[model samples]
Target: MDGTTLYAVDGGIARITLNRPGARNALNDQMIGELLDALDRAKHDDGVRVIVLTGAGDRAFCAGADLDGLGRDGMGVNDVRDSAPFRLFTAFPALGKPIIARLAGHAVAGGLGLAAACDLVIAADDVKLATPEVNVGLWPMMIMAIINRNVAPKHAFKLYYTGSRITAAEGREIGLVTEVVPRADLDARVDELAGVIASKSPLGLRRGRDAFFAIEGRPLEDQVAYLLSELVELAGTEDAKEGITAFLENRPPDFRGR
Candidate 1:
């Protein structure tokens, strides 16, 4: 939408890159707006089967929110709730498609929240991650929701309270990072993963992702029931039928996002 963010689609994968390398690709209002716009576009585009979120620079995936634009007192509850970060992070999982975070550098504070929001987060092995809001006498109230879903409760609290950064390996071990690769191999790894996901039947991927998101705070029994129902529903989709036909015929399936 704007130079603050860059959006491109190629080979069924939509790449959303946060600009502003000088600021470590910080989430300023304009950048956030542009990123949200890009996400909305990618979500609706039938050609885009997968989304990859990354930053422009090698120094940091994101240094967090742009404090200069936030003013002296920073944001209040209403401001935070209305901000693009809140909407982007909270609404991401429900988009009915997979999103992968390609992190080649540090992701601190709200940056970590953005990474966690994605379905998969692949980071460079040397990357740093943290939620250091408490160090500034503030709390990562909004981000904690997404972070808690990934990290263990005690470990999440430790990151929030101590303002200490963790390595990509530790982040993966704690469930925050999906994969860790050497910096030089980050792009290859991300590409490999994106390519694999992009080859799936779009209809099945959407149904599966949506079903999983729908069961998020539900009981195990409810989750299983919903998943079973979703499976039956998916079996009725045109793409599912085509996939089965292709498998039986020894041919590649052609999914139309049906």
Candidate 2:
């Protein structure tokens, strides 16, 4: 759908690939616009139940924002807000659908933010994730916002401060990754999860997700009370009726994503 970002579908899964491998898939202006457009479309499209994001070629899922041509074409530090890497991850919570990151290689700087933005991430076992902006006399301060949400504050601080790279397993341990499989199994693992999501009820998934974040960090007593009330609303849905009936009948529920 976009030049720097590749889009494809298998069943209900929409796979969005970063295509600038030669540039280490660094996110540039073109890639950003395309990705935002694509994500917005996916959120509204009923045909797309799950979306998986990865980078083309194996060397890098994304190396972060492209720095090579900075100031070469009327771009400055301020102009960077329009860059794809910045826009993609920063506005992620607004994306109403589930995004699975299929990280095949290194995720650096802005790439790290993208990885952290996904609702879930299934990365290659050998994948390396880091935000090395400090090493270059810069800081991943912006990306750190997204990182702080998924990873422990201390862990996020340690990686950003040291500017050192960590393996996919370590990333998982620190909570940025949901699963890590061998390189050979990367696609298969992503596909498997995507299929699982595709089979479920989209409306229920979206509603639950929307409510999930709203409830985070709230007091346990308050959250529990809120959730209890929320269930009443869900029970009013047609999809919930099917789920309850299917459970009683001991059969899979046919969800229309209502």
Candidate 3:
């Protein structure tokens, strides 16, 4: 796992780079295992205030599962979800920290699932996004699960049934991306966002993020209850104390990603 998946930390930002450029960062079993493990590691590591997911080269953030994840020993739709697709990131909302997908290249099929599941996504204007599995006789079944959560049903169906690739700019319009920047500006933009995220109290960030998703599918009364519960839970965390003290002192508070 040491060289197969590169992990780097600068300030509070942890970057997870999928290292199989030769395979276009495809989700081979090893890559899948490593990504899950890396996400687990990123969540537990206090130094990691936010995570940035990217690939090793210019060709793909991921081309979805490897050519192998589709064939004889390949994953079926449900298997891909359980083994490597949306489940990996679906487990993420509980982490209470931001995970941003820095789409430096193409994100198709399950690769698009990666971007869809992230808390934020930023990509180059030229970055390609698609659920091209239909062209190969498979619909974007697993990817569709998350896609429906993030996108309109009709558009999600259009992406699945058509299998046409879209630019990152179009992805933003369709709710699949957060921002589209020039290729040269992708990293700086993600880094800037990471810094802004780090500026907030991590405890409140986690509470709010959890409440946000928890309330999304709930009624108004339930939403208020959930938010109130989150507030109570957050009041017990250290960041609350630091945040209040910092305001009183008129100085920046250093956060510990507790």
Kindly list the per-residue Cα lDDT of model 3 for residues 101-194, writing each as its tens digit.
9998899888899888898999988889999998989887666877888888888888988999988988898899999999999889998999
Q: Which stretches of candidate 3 lie over 4 Å from their true place?
A: 1-3, 69-87
Candidate with top TM-score is 1
What clash pairs does model 2 have? Answer: 32-84
All candidates in order of lDDT, best leading: 1, 2, 3
What TM-score against the true fold does each predicted structure earn? 0.94, 0.91, 0.89
Candidate 2 regions off by >4 Å? 69-86, 217-222
Q: Kindly report which residue stretches of model 1 are placed more than 4 angstroms away from their true locations once superposed.
A: 71-81
lDDT of each: 0.88, 0.84, 0.82
- Residues 72-140 of candidate 1: C-alpha lDDT, one tens digit per residue: 223455566665666777779767779999998799998999999899999998899998999889999
Displacement of residue 257 (Cα, Å) in model 1 is: 1.6
Q: Encode model 2's per-residue lDDT on 121-184: one tens digit a residue.
A: 9999988999898898988877788889888889988998999999999999999999999989
Give the Cα error of residue 68 in candidate 2, in Å. 2.8
Pick by lDDT: which candidate is best? Answer: 1
